[model samples]
Target: MDPLHYRAFTTPSGGGNPAGVVLDASGMTDARMQEIAADLGYSETAFLDPGDGGHFRIRYFSPLAEVDFCGHATVASAVALADRDGAEGHYVFHANVGPIPVEVHSTERGYAATLRSVVPSVAPLDALAELLRVLGWERGDLAPDLPVGVAFAGLSHPVLWAASRARLADLAYDFAAMKDLMIAQGWGTVSLLHRASPDLIHARNAFAVGGVVEDPATGAAAAALGGFLRAHGLLPADGRFTVMQGEDMGQPCRIEVDASGDGGVRVSGTAAPIPVA
Candidate 1:
């Protein structure tokens, strides 16, 4: 089947993160899925096998590896299903990360999806020096209050808060070495952020482990960040925030995070079809 392409977390003024969605991936082998994902070369691709109505078995792959979950791909896949089947669709997905509940609805921005993540956890980073060495960042460059931690919603992400927007924008690190470190640390992406306000944030992600330079809009990382914030007392249990990413990449994306309602963190985004060229 042909892959469906969509850019998730799009704003009217800016493009968003692109992902490939295979609505009918039943009976496909792991090798076949990896080949397809490598061919598509999107940051991530979602493959689904339909189960009961609104239920599916989903899998995520980067060019190089299969992952537990992918937030942007989930958003894109949800919208793709809605486009094919109809709006106000409720979906239950069983990915490698476990079960995820997603609901798609039409919004003023466009077709949007909300995915409530599994209960998350945050842990202190033990290899801070090695991490800094890989990122080429210094102790003084970090926000004193934010510190650093590894957060997990579905996958693990090392969260770093820059003291200023300037610091965040000047992101340059040893890619090959960073990839090695990320692999050793069992991390998906490194969530680098600068808090613009209590509810607004500027962000970037280094996804070396996924064989990518950066992720334009990382939904999974956004969810994990919300968990980290609430755990650290930076955000209330029911707080809401927006993460602005992909600005430097020219694919500006907006992600809404709700660390509210029960113990799960909810990540929401709008997805639009990517026209074939």
Candidate 2:
């Protein structure tokens, strides 16, 4: 299998979250795919099984295990497909989460892919105290406006809105403790965020559950964030915003979000191949 490394959500090669893309994983077993992902050491790697026409079956695997969905890897895979297939207009991906529709366009920035996630829903806050204690975060650290809640786009992520940007930047935490809580709660990641403006936000994600300290940029979390904002009436009915993540890790990623009045959210970003290893 030819594995390609690509970074999603940034124009520059050094920015965005790096993902390993296996363009063809037909003969590979699940164990082999898992081993490849673990060895690659990215938060997630996408395996694409080419199907008839432009449709494909995609699977996501983390170093520790396979996940239902992954946004950055999906973006990376779409760009990889475009690079090989001469920029197919749009492709349908059958993922573990559901049917994901991705459109690729050739821009000055290269292949920019936009994916419309499955209809998102906010999960109720049932165990906020347990989650807070596990992270060693005080209740005062949370933003009153944003609040704490669970949101799911493709995967479930607990949204913890920080009261200040400083708190969001200070992200050192007990990895083992967080991993325990996340695994027990079946959370993919903790979506830490600080609102800069009504339409702009700074975000960080702790992905201990995925066996990664943090994710540089997370598309699934971004979709969940948009859903959280709309579900809680934090953003306007027809709102659009941008999320800046991965800056603290020095690989800044920009994620554009659009929330329709009816309830769907769209996330868009640029993806490029990383330098060959």
Candidate 3:
């Protein structure tokens, strides 16, 4: 199957996280999928097979291994489908985690997709000291207000809020150690963040566990962060916020997260087609 290239959380001209989307992967084997993902060299690639009643069976694979779920790739796949089909409807995706609903709409800029995550959760992180050491961060560097925890939307991420934006910007970390720790701990990413305002936040997700140094924009992590904020009473019961990521990488991704209901945060962003060779 020929893969459709799409960049999720992007601007008009294309600065976002690129992903490979195989919309009709009916008979593809797991080994082939892994090979394709590795060959593409994106953070992740999505393989989709049409399921009953407009639902799709989706699988996400990184260069190294298959992940339970991936938000940016999901967004990219949905938007690509919408471009091929039509926008203004919801697409059901059956993932390794659970059933996820992605709503697509034709916005002024382009096709935008919003995915409602599986029941989000937050819990205390166990090895905080070792995790911090891997990141070259100390306890003092953490934002005392936002407690360190493991947050899960579909995949688990260690949510660490930095005390200062500069600290977040300076994101030099030991990739090998972090990858080892993440594999052992079953963490998908280490989401380092800095809140600039009540409604705006800056984020950097280290994704060494997935054989990638970093993710430009992570919708799964964004949803998990929203859930963590609401669970800890850091934000209002109904809250909407923007996360700006990839600024340091010069790609510039924007993700909008809305935690309006009791469970499952909604993550939204626009996607653009990447020029394929």
Candidate 4:
């Protein structure tokens, strides 16, 4: 398959998470898809099998394994589909977890994509103490007002809000231990966040579960965070926020998240094509 490389959740100049988009994966086997993803070596690669009634079966694979869903890949795939089919329509993706609807529009900078996630839910972390030990962080390092739990939009992410931006920036973790913990707990990623303001947040995601050290831009985590904030009363029912991420890694990314009253979150970002090697 000839895949197109696109950087999702980035500025027009292209600083975001890179994803591989296979516009057509018609008769590909699961093993072939996994091999292709490992070869590409991106955090996530999206494969699409177009179906009738304007729907497509989407699958996401990382270098290591297949994930239930991926936010950045979803956005990237939406933009890719729009570019191929014309940038003026909405596409429904039948993902492993649920049906996610992505709408593409023509922005001044370029084409942008917005995905409405599945009904989100939040639950308390089962092994909070073990998690803290693995991260070498004390409970006091967390924000007092923020909720500590695992939130799921499509995949599960542990929502950990730091007390300060400095705390969020100081991210040196035992990758092996964290990866083991994530796998044992069946987590997608560990979302580290700092609330800069009522409408702004700084985030860094530990994506060891996906066999990546960190994710420059994590749409699933952002959507989960929005749901957690609403469920915990930290934000209103209809709230919106901006997430600034990937700065420490030198690839700055911006993500827009909107929370609705019905517990559905929308994640929006712009994707740019990357030069193939």
Winning candidate number (TM-score): 1
C-alpha RMSD values across all candidates: 1.1, 1.5, 1.2, 1.3
Cα lDDT tens digits for candidate 2, 197-268: 988899999999889999999999998888888888887545889899999999999988887664456888
Superposed on all Cα atoms, model 1 deviates from the true structure by an RMSD in Å of: 1.1
lDDT minimum window of 10 residues, candidate 2: 258-267
Pick by TM-score: 1 or 3, better one? 1
Q: Indicate whether candidate 1 or candidate 2 has the larger TM-score.
A: 1
- lDDT, candidates in the order shown: 0.92, 0.87, 0.91, 0.89
Q: How would you encode candidate 3's per-residue C-alpha lDDT over 188-269 as one tens digit per residue?
A: 8889999888789999999998898999999889999999988887775359999999999999999999987777899999
Instruction: Give the clashing pairs for model 2.
Output: none
Candidates ranked, most accurate by TM-score first: 1, 3, 4, 2
lDDT for 138 in candidate 1 is: 95
Candidate 3 or 1, higher lDDT: 1
Q: In model 2, which regions exceed 4 Å deviation?
A: 11-14, 236-238
**Candidates 2 and 3 compared by TM-score, better number:** 3
User: What value does the lDDT take at residue 103 in candidate 1?
Assistant: 92
> 2 or 3, which is superior by lDDT?
3
List the candidates' TM-scores in order.
0.98, 0.96, 0.97, 0.96
TM for candidate 3 is 0.97
Q: Give the local distance difference test score of model 4.
A: 0.89
